[model samples]
Target: MARTYHVYIMSNRHRTVLYIGVTGNLAHRVHAHQDGTGSAFTRRYNVTDLIYAEPYADVDEALRREKQLKRWTRAKKLGLIRRQNPTLQTIQGPYG
Candidate 1:
């Protein structure tokens, strides 16, 4: 079986803070965030909403994309999210 990876962005309720991460199991990872056990930054900022996600067959590519997104400016990140999620709504499901 081929392993899949995902680069995802999470945001706070106010949509002011963003958190980018790569995970092999997107649903589980996002659930952890929602449960406030994902990361210190996410838990502190209440960044539990799934704003954006990109999938890749390679974990290295997902990690690279995560790094690239992390290096991007807030505006750039928001733009990327808006391009796919115009309203910035929370994506609820296995892959959103």
Candidate 2:
């Protein structure tokens, strides 16, 4: 079976911060973020809400998209998220 790659976005409750990341295991990564074990930036910003995620068959594609999103302005990033989540509320993680 082929492994999947994901480009994911996380945010704090107040939507005051955004974090973009690429991971081979979305569920594990999300768990880490929620538990404050993901990264210094995420833990420091209190960005634990899983907001958006996109899967890719290719790791390169996922990495490239992650890099692209990280470079975007906050407005642009929010626009992308709004396209899928108009209400901009916290989204359930991919896994239960």
Candidate 3:
């Protein structure tokens, strides 16, 4: 079976901080974040909301996208998220 990769963004409830990450299993990765085991930054900032995600066929592509997004200005990142999720709602659960 072909592998799938995901580039995702997580934000705090107040939307003050954004966390970008790449993973082969988005659902599990998000679950870790939600469970407070993902990263120190996410845990400290309380950034568990999965606001955005994009799928890629290759891990390299997903990593590249993650790096690109990480380098973006906060405004640009917010714009990107807003474009896909205008309401900036928390996207969790299966396949999140």
Candidate 4:
């Protein structure tokens, strides 16, 4: 079965940088981020932490959310992250 996932936001411990992304496999995507193979921005910014995510049943919804996140202001993004992950814990590694 094809899996769909919503957009997600990731940040470092200090929440100094943000990485917005979408993937059908959240675990795999998070793994890639931790591995530094997700994207140049994430790798450069050391955004290997999964701060927030919202699942969507449809790919279109996920894509829309991703776009919306991209357009969000920094404060809005921080609020979103803080709502779900106030402590800013590192998303466990793929195997972990």
lDDT of 2 by residue, 1-96 (tens): 999988988999999999999999989998999898999999999999888888899999999999999999999999999998887788875542
Name the regions of candidate 1 deviating beyond 4 angstroms.
none
- TM-score, one value per model: 0.96, 0.94, 0.95, 0.85
lDDT of 1 by residue, 73-93 (tens): 999998999999999999989
Candidate order by decreasing TM-score? 1, 3, 2, 4
lDDT (Cα atoms) of all candidates against the true structure: 0.92, 0.90, 0.93, 0.81
Model 3 lDDT tens row, 13-62: 99999999999999989989989999999999998899999999999999
Q: What is the lDDT of residue 37 in candidate 2?
A: 97
lDDT of 2: 0.90
TM-score, structure 3 vs. true: 0.95
Angstrom error at residue 57, model 2: 0.4
lDDT comparing candidate 1 with the true structure: 0.92
User: What's the residue-level lDDT of 40 in candidate 4?
Assistant: 91
lDDT, residue 18, candidate 4: 85
- True-vs-predicted CA distance for residue 65, candidate 4, Å: 1.0
Quote the positional error of residue 25 for candidate 4 in Å: 0.4
